[model samples]
Target chain A: MTQTFEIAVIGATGTVGETLVQILEELAFPVGTLYLLAGSNSAGASVPFRGKNVRVREVDEFDFSKAQLAFFAAGPAVTLGFAPRATAAGCAVIDLSGALPAEQAPPVVPEANAHVLEGLQKPFQVSSPSPSATNLAVVLAPLRGLVDIQRVSVTANLAVSALGREAVSELARQTAELLNVRPLEPAFFDRQMAFNLLAQVGKPDAKGHTDLEKRLIHELRAVLDTPALKVSATCVQAPVFFGDSLTVSLQLAAPVDLAAVNRALEAAPGIELVEEGDYPTAVGDAVGQDVVYAGRIRAGVDDPAELNMWLTSDNVRKGAALNAVQLAQLLIKRLV
Target chain B: MTQTFEIAVIGATGTVGETLVQILEELAFPVGTLYLLAGSNSAGASVPFRGKNVRVREVDEFDFSKAQLAFFAAGPAVTLGFAPRATAAGCAVIDLSGALPAEQAPPVVPEANAHVLEGLQKPFQVSSPSPSATNLAVVLAPLRGLVDIQRVSVTANLAVSALGREAVSELARQTAELLNVRPLEPAFFDRQMAFNLLAQVGKPDAKGHTDLEKRLIHELRAVLDTPALKVSATCVQAPVFFGDSLTVSLQLAAPVDLAAVNRALEAAPGIELVEEGDYPTAVGDAVGQDVVYAGRIRAGVDDPAELNMWLTSDNVRKGAALNAVQLAQLLIKRLV
Candidate 1:
């Protein structure tokens, strides 16, 4: 008989949380009972699942110990306050937000570091990964092990949905307004994010790098577990909705050819290669896809030591929901 | 007093031609008489100029020698056949297309190469510079002299306006169709050109690089006279209607810091630096502007020998119209 576990989805009304619930049902994650919890804003909202409408309950009133596992997709503030509570109630937590404290609980991209998660014994354990970093790290992990990466330069064309649902709707609304010859009113972003690319994504920290850029640096290092890897990234807020596209240039310690890199990517799991005519695009090919679609593979013009590629992934799926679900599944397999 | 010249604008009904005429009026180029010539399709169309409508005349019937200067804004096929005829008829030609014969007539960015136009002696001479290459070359010329640029990798996010007027309207129409939940019809471009990015702009050659990429390589070499400079580019057809944005990463022979890069950019002509808390964007800053806005200056993480920058320019203005007008002005001064 297949044993089932009780599960709870915090912030059930958000996009990532909804996607997490869907993936659980789609993957048939052996759920005995499901509780969808939210704050007053989305408390009464009804989410359909398994041929039934489950109304959202207040997260404050819901008993955390009732569910053996909890997936937190709330914002940083909510996750900060409630994640510890859920853990104290003896629930293993898989957090989609990167706002976890530096408490050494282990930030994980399951594909990259699944070895560490095989024999965990701690009850109520919690871990998180940066959404943007999760996608990049999964793609880089296999390559990092194969090639001695000397330096890496990344230009990430991130979609508005990377921000949240509001930003995606804002793009559609602003684009409509502009198309009708009406003035665009900016909200949720500093400048017009529709039909325009913004160089800055988040607020700047002390080093003149945007907070998003700095986060990518820290999180990529943590996910790849390479403390000294040299990486630089330019985060651009592109005028798309659901996916993040990255142009990655890697400088290796030794020279390599197209065949070797192709071998590396093909061997790596959770990545789909698009090699033929018309490379993958965010709007056209990457939406609703679990695997990162990588294409436009070319060697550096200057030397054989470097390689360049284009990567597109649905940031909502692989970047957040699927990674979280995979980590949750790993947590289950670790139970002794 | 300013000396007047008789000028004809080929392809007078197109976007580049309309912009060129407006710029001539805005910059007050000394014109004795203007002839707006188009093909059979736009023969009777009237373009507004100097507060009145100027009817488009048939290019086949018009005498090329009647005007001393001919600006070939038409497609390459027309220019290929007519440019030599205009030159043979003693009309000086400023061909914007890069398909000119391989003989070394100065391919100029006036700011970087005004010295080459000082003593021209060919009576029916023609010169050309690719629009995309002109923007990139103007920015790189200053840095090429300062730093030993080992290699450059560029990601150009080009707008539909670069393709011409029909592509612009296609974006509008496709966006409306997509917003209304209707299927998109790809007419001018191979794929849907609304809210999507295409990796290939021109036809791909044998080496998998697009024709546009080949042009950038050839023209940048001709503009900077750096035959050995290593350069590679990926041209993306972005959803924006105007202004092209570029992300350029340069690997130098020696280490440099933020202050040095800032100093070089500050000293460069025809450049505007956007610093701290704000950066230049294609939409908010570049449209209708004559200056190339360069900002988001960052150095490499692991090595100080590398630098990255964000560049945006009005492709119609500095890329085509203003550069052509400036060259015409240069030719006028060279007449003595």
Candidate 2:
């Protein structure tokens, strides 16, 4: 028998949240009913789900008691406040934000670590991976099968506007002004977002790592189940509007061939291998796509232990919304 | 009595060649006489130099008989054929291509390795440093005084249109056409040079490194005089029309602070530091400028040895024409 699930989409108006609604419609997921939840400011607005307008209710007032699943795209504060309540209501929470209390939550990439969510008796919480995690996970999938990862270093040229819708608008407006067209005043970002790249992403942690970078390293380890792995990241914001690109260098525990690496990626789901001479997938190419586009894979000429590749993904979709929806779909498949 | 130099500029109507004429005029070089040489197709054209319309002479017909210095900005083939003839004519040959026979040529970056060219009893043959070397030499000047180098990994997102005027025009036309503005057929590059980033630059070496990447690696070693140092580069073409941006990750020999890096770069000539907040220098900012703009400098939280920085420069000026002219100025001051 076909199963239908009731779902709550928290932060329904956000970039990721909006994408979640769109993907649900596109995939034709068996949705019996949908709830749209957001903060006080966004409450009362409506987003379309299954061809019907669903009004967004404040998170505090939302009834999670009847929902079988909840997708949290809101910030940590909202996720922290509402996720436990929803879980208490017996709803599985798929969180896109990294703010979930780690002890109770498990970070997941559906393809890489979907099994981690299969046996949870209690209402389980799964997080949508960060842009970096979304990038590294797909590339790592091929490598993990071949050799153990000794160390991984990634430098990200993250697009500044990937922060949110406001950031994206701010960049578009500022770019117009910078080129003597029209002024887009700075409000969403702390500084000028036009024609410039920023090095800072998430708030700085006590140890100086950006919160996003730290989370990516942590999430990578957690999802891969390699506790002893060494991971370091230097994330910088680029002027692009949508996609995030990373130059990843990995040191493996054993030697691996480039052809084998390509084979692994070819077999992986939701990954499109971009070959040399193909355009390096940019923000525009990834803006509405769910798949991770990867290219420029090269084994180091001097060292077999070293491998390099470029990973590009739509920060809003694969990095957040689609992953959340995918997790929800997996939960439904595993549960009654 | 002042010694006068008769100079001939091969490829005189091209971007670098035009800039060379302008710079020579601006620097007031002692030009006893000047000859402009171009391909047979451009033989009848005239380019303005020092307020005079200098008729372009066929490169094949040009006699270097009276010239004391010859600047070859033509392609490798022309340099391979004509540079030797100029040298045989008792002229000091400054080749931009570096494809000149190794036995007769020594690579030179005026600021970093000009001393190598001093007091040559035989007419010296020097080739311009690669764009990457020209950039690294200027930025490394400050770093050398601050920290010892261990290794560097660089990914060059080079704009191939930086190759020449024809490529630039082709790219602009193609971009416009791609956006449905007008038809701009491909001419200079092998494919449509619009809205795309190509990965190959120059010819690929047997091991698959691009000619420019190979030259940069070798030229950097020669200019820095660091034979044992390790370097790896991935060069890719971007849709940009002018500047080149390098995302550099360095493993320093000693621990260094980000502040020290900022201060060092600030004090360094030909480099503008854009470190604070989200202010990253863009290709537009560096276009038509001489300075290499360094920004978004950050330290790796997990690994102190790893530091990330972004560098952008006008490939035509600082990367090519301006640098060659600077070498000429240095030669005039120290040798002539």
Candidate 3:
């Protein structure tokens, strides 16, 4: 007889959470019972799964012992609040938030660092890195030995959907108002978001680095297992709604071989390398895709040691929900 | 007596050309006869100068000798076709198009290298660098002495207006169609550009570097007079109507002092350095502005030798038209 485990999805009504539930259904991950949980404000909302509406219950009142595994798809505070309880009940926790310390819950991108999972013990805890880090890791993992990467500089054009459904709706409203020639009153965003790009994604610290930017640097280094790698990151909030577009430039220790790099990228899993002379964009190519689309690959104009690329992927899907689900798939094997 | 020279603006009906004419009036540049010339399609159009509308004549028929100076704001082909005639007619040439070789028409950002203008002979020809190059030259000129720069990486978020009026109108139309739930049929742009960012601004060469990207690298090196400087440039076509946003990361030879860097930027001309907490956006802060708006300045997360910054400016006004006009302001002295 086949056996299946019951699972709980925290923050199930949120954008990434709902997508997580949908991905679970799409991937058919041997689910027996699904519990959708959210905070008090969203507890009554219903998320659809397998053509049925699953009403969300409050995370505060739920008992963690009922489920063998739980996915925390909410903010850092929510993960910090309920993660311990779930782990204490012997539930394996997969955190989508960058809340737990790297020592406690090592960030894992299955395509890059799947072997890290073998190191964890019972009542396992693993973290899915931030959207930018996850997408970059998937693309960069293949080039680990192909080039001696010395420094990496990335400019991430993030979508509004990364913020939440409210930010997504705000973009639509702002665009409509501006198109109709109505006076724009910015709400969800501090400034006009339609037809514009916001340089800073979040509040910067004293050193003028936003949490998102620092997160990309830290998580990328952790997943790549290169602690001393020099990374420069800029997370800009684009007018886009769904996917994240990244412009990446890498400084290598020696002149690179373009033919070998292309061959490696083509053979790598979890990435779709578009043919040369054609590039991918977030809305058209990456919005509903499962793999990260990479194109415009070339060495620098004059410096052969420099390499540049354009990458796009679904931030909520491949970057977050799908990554968490992939980790869960690996965990299910050892759970029983 | 105040002496004014006759000036002709080729491609006067273009976005940059129109703005150049307007700046000539606003900055009170000495203009004797302002002859507006464009291609046959735009020849019959009229553009406002001072209080009256000036009729644009056909460039093919306009006599180059009729003006002492000519501003070639059209495409490189048009500049290549008519600039030699203007020079032969003893007309001082200011080419906004990157058609002429750097040796013949040296790229100049007045704030960075106005000294290049002093070496010119009669019927002088000077090229106004690309918007991205011009903006970067202005910001980097002040930092030349402050840091020992080794390499530069840039991701330029360009507006559709850089492609002129048709591209701008397409963005508006694509946006409205998407907002109204109507089927989108992309016209000027090859893809859905409403809420999407096109990774490539123009067709890339065999090496995957577009002409615009190469122009930026070449022009920046010339303007800063750093011929061997290493630069990695990625120019993305954003959905914005105006203003270009650039994310820059510089690798320095040694550790940087943040306080000293801030002081240099604060004292720099042609730039507005926003405070630490508040940042600038293209639509909210840079559109229709003369100076580049810079914010989110910091070092790398762990590397002190790396400096990153965000910059936004009116691509047509401050980047092209105003810079050209500023050059002409200095040229009027030598013209007479």
Candidate 4:
């Protein structure tokens, strides 16, 4: 007999949430019944599932006990408000927001730290890290044995789409306004977002580090299970719309063999290592892709012990939705 | 009496060359006569100088001995072919192209290595470092006194105009095609460069490092006078039409004081330090500006021995043309 579980997806109208629903359909997960829920403002929207329109209902009115699993894909406040209700109703929760503390819902990227799930109890809670951290974890997990990484410095060139649907539209609007030679009246972003790069993404704390950068550093360390690791991160808001491009440099304790690094990446799951001399770009290769594309892999120009590479991935799909769904697949096996 | 020199501008029709001509006018450089020279293809084109349109002539037919100083802003091949001729004619040379060897034309960033000019002989020759290196050198030169740096990692987000005027037009055309939903047939770039980031700028060598990256590392080391310093550089071509943004991380020998770092940056010439919280961008702050904008200065999240900063500058002016002009200003004092 085939056993299937009922599922609920919160924030179904969001960019990542919509992609999550689509990926659930594409992966053909054993979903007995799918419930799409959103806030009151978006309650009437309908999302397609199994070639049929599944109307979104208000989460305030939906009975959480009816669904065996719930995915929180909204902002931190929304997750903070509704996540407890779903967990109290004996439903497992997978949070895309970083609202829950690591000890309460340990961040998980299956490729890097699936073992963190073995000790979970019923009504399980887990977190999918930020796009930058998840993408890095997937690519770095395979290299754990090849090199002794002492420090990591990453510059994450983020896409505007990660902000939301509004940001995507704003980039288009700004680009159009510039191309047409119209005076730009900035709206979504505070300044010019077309053909420009913003050094900081969100507002920084008193320490001069944005929330996104702090989250990446903390989440990457946690997922890689190297809590004492030193990570220097900078998150820049690029003019890009859909994918993230990251340049990473690592300090190794000993000289690393380039050929061995290539072989490891080639054999790793959830990663596509580009061939030598050719590199990957967000639009040409990584958009809508399931795996993180790693390229330009080489040691430092003069220092043999240093490693540098470029990584690009579909932020909404592989970085967020797909990672959460992969966690769900693993969580279901132990769901009692 | 105001001393004036006869100046020859090679590649006068190029983006940098045209900008150099304008900057010379803005700075009110003493000039007896301005001679514009370009390749045979670009000859007959005119560039405006000091409220007059000066016609460009072919470099092959021009007499180098007629000018007291020559500025080479063309490609390396062009400089390699004509720089020797200019020097042989006893004309002091300032080359923007990285063609001449360091021993002959040492790389110079006026803010970092103005002292290198004091050692020069007659018919002085100097090379302006690449944009990434010049930008980094200007920002880091002020910090050499505050911190004992161990290693540096940089991710340079370069603008399209750095390649030339044709690359700028290609970016605009490709962007319009993408926005209009038309099928894109990439002409200037090998792939879709609109709303995308190319991981590598130029062709990489057998060791997987591109010429641009190597040039940045080499030129930066030379200008900083830190030959043993290890630098990891990744040059990514961005969608921006002008201005270059760089994210730099430095490993220090000991804990760094954030206040001292800020004070040092504030006092440095050729650099504008933004307010602590408010950051700078390439287009909003750096484009068409004479000074490099430095912002988001902070120590590492957990490691006090690490320093991180963001820098953006006008690649054509402050990075290349203005730096070259500044070198010429210094070199002419010793020209006999």
Clashing pairs in 3: none
RMSD of each: 2.9, 3.7, 0.7, 1.0
- TM-scores for all predictions: 0.91, 0.87, 0.99, 0.99
Candidate number that wins on lDDT, 1 or 4: 4
- Compute the lDDT for candidate 1: 0.79
Residue pairs whose backbone atoms clash in candidate 2: none
Q: What is the lDDT of candidate 2?
A: 0.74
Evaluated at residue B151, the lDDT of candidate 2 is 67
List the candidate numbers ranked by TM-score, top first. 3, 4, 1, 2
Please give the interface root mean square deviation for model 1, in Å: 2.0
All candidates' lDDT scores? 0.79, 0.74, 0.94, 0.93
User: Candidates ranked by DockQ, best first?
Assistant: 3, 4, 1, 2
- Clashes (backbone N, CA, C under 3 Å), per candidate, total 0, 0, 0, 0
- What DockQ does candidate 2 score? 0.23
Which residue pairs show backbone clashes in model 1?
Answer: none
Model 2 chain B poorest 10 in a row by lDDT? B275-284
Task: Tell me the tens digit of each residue's lDDT in model 4 across A21-98.
Answer: 999999988899999999999999999999999999999998999999999998899899999999999999999988
Q: What DockQ results do all the predictions give, each relative to the true complex?
A: 0.47, 0.23, 0.93, 0.92
Cα lDDT tens digits, model 1, B87-184, are 77878888877657535356778877777776555654545576678788778877766788877777788888888898888888988998888988
Q: Of the candidates shown, which would achieve the greatest DockQ relative to the real structure? A: 3
- Fnat of candidates, each listed: 0.39, 0.12, 0.96, 0.93
